[model samples]
Target: MYCVSCRNIHMFFPPFSHLTIVSLLFRCPWTVMANFKGHALPGSFFLIVGLWWSVKYPLKYFHRKGKSSQLTHYYQRLEITEAAIRTLFSVIGVLAEQFVPDGPHLHLSQESHWVKLMNWQHSTMYLFFAASGVADMLTYLSAHTPVGLDRLVMAVAVFNEGFLFYYHVHNRPPLDQHIHSLLLYAVFGGALSIALEVILRDNIVLELFRTSLAILQGTWFWQIGFVLFPPFGGPEWDQSDHNNIMFITMCFSWHYLAALCTVAISYSLVHCFLTRVKRHGEREIIGIQKLKSDHTYQTALLGGSDED
Candidate 1:
């Protein structure tokens, strides 16, 4: 659904050639509906979740380091709040997909069916995530909904997301397909790790791997936005250029490396900071006990009553 005007977005992606790039540059605004906002929104979500998990899983593993506990992973202590946030984001996605002026507004018929096929697809993806959130909420409140149902649902959602994206950008330009296909690596990797979480229960390795992939997803989404839309007022990529595609692939590798470094840094900081805090606390307690012992000895040596 490529259009010359700014109002209509083309696949939340754009530019197949130099001419097309120029057109998008002059026509599209900084916040193009084509997919910049879309990518950034979800990117921010993944980034936050990834960073949080990065800190949390490491902290949990360190805290439980010599303990004889069957579980040694981050637990969803704020399941209720987490579920609410997930549901809220999904709802926003669905509403934005269906209710914009150019949107079909939920109308699916012979005449209106082709209005925006991708929007419907996007809505369906969001629905699965929303279902996962609801499942988490139910698991938190209900006693008989089956253990690990929420995790299973979330794994399905992430899998479905990758499945959709795999089929979403086919027959498109080389650069377009290449850049988007890069996302499949993160999406599918995260999906598999999350599915593993369902089976492994509290395996910190699987959880950490999932969080690392999530960080990749977050950063890559923003990369896609810059490649496709270029919100910072620059020329768009040549969607048919092999050099551009190769560069993007290389750049994606860098993004993954950066994500890994970020995860490692997060773990190190949490471990170091918490370890120092714990050490200081133990020293404080020992100092207090020693003071009490010294006071008792002095009173006894001075011929004071034992009670004194």
Candidate 2:
């Protein structure tokens, strides 16, 4: 039998334990989305871009038949088009924030400097997206593609993502912690992939990892929408039973399904391009032959073993 004083001491010490402290720092009260439109808009952008990248890379890889130096910039026209669309979306989002008087607009003219800063914080995510868009446009528009400029763009994206992660972690409620944490992981993973790409010059695996993270990010956006918004049982902010294991399992299962669907769509698109597009088909065939020849020559030089 434990003494009452000892029991009290144990309880007190447990609350101050490292695990408890970490949980307190990382966790917060559950929060519902007040500005659904703002989230959904950027969410859509990420989803579309992610789906495109995931599909584009695989098709490009097969088309080039593993001879390409850099799989990323192979489709120059598509890159430019994506950049233009991102820039357009960023501009529109910014403009809407500035002009839209009724909706979730930023309160930039608060009397208190602290309040003004907080207002800026609210819009930082969009601002970072806009900055990234501008950087992407500049990257594509440069007359002479300098390595430094490319690194700078990647660095800016990394910083933006880091900031976004912090914002979501602190500002979002505990109920949404899992979704936001997944997004943070995706952003951080993307940043790491970009850094690796910059260092390694061109790594196809790293590029694919980056695109996979993008797909995960997009999937999280839809999950957040479904969990926080209407038509799917409404927000979970006020609920105390958010730690349902079955619900969590379902959420992850949905993500896996979404990823598989994206891959299938990408493959189908690649097949269509190879079958219907005359120029692309011809180029791919030539590229494949060249790759085979190169492999054979390397194998012969290495005494019939291409391992080295």
Instruction: Go through the candidates in order and give each one's C-alpha lDDT.
Output: 0.80, 0.61
RMSD, each candidate, Å? 5.4, 15.8
Cα lDDT tens digits, model 2, 117-215, are 422443565566666666666666786666535535655665675665566546455555655565666677777777776676545576666666677
lDDT of 1: 0.80
Off by over 4 Å in 2: 1-34, 66-74, 102-106, 113-119, 169-173, 231-238, 268-308
lDDT at 165, model 1 = 89
Model 1 poorest 10 in a row by lDDT: 1-10
Per-residue alpha-carbon lDDT of candidate 1 for residues 13-50, written as tens digits (9 for 90 to 100): 45465567556554646336556766776787788878
Which one wins on lDDT? 1
Per-candidate TM-score against the hidden true structure:
0.83, 0.64
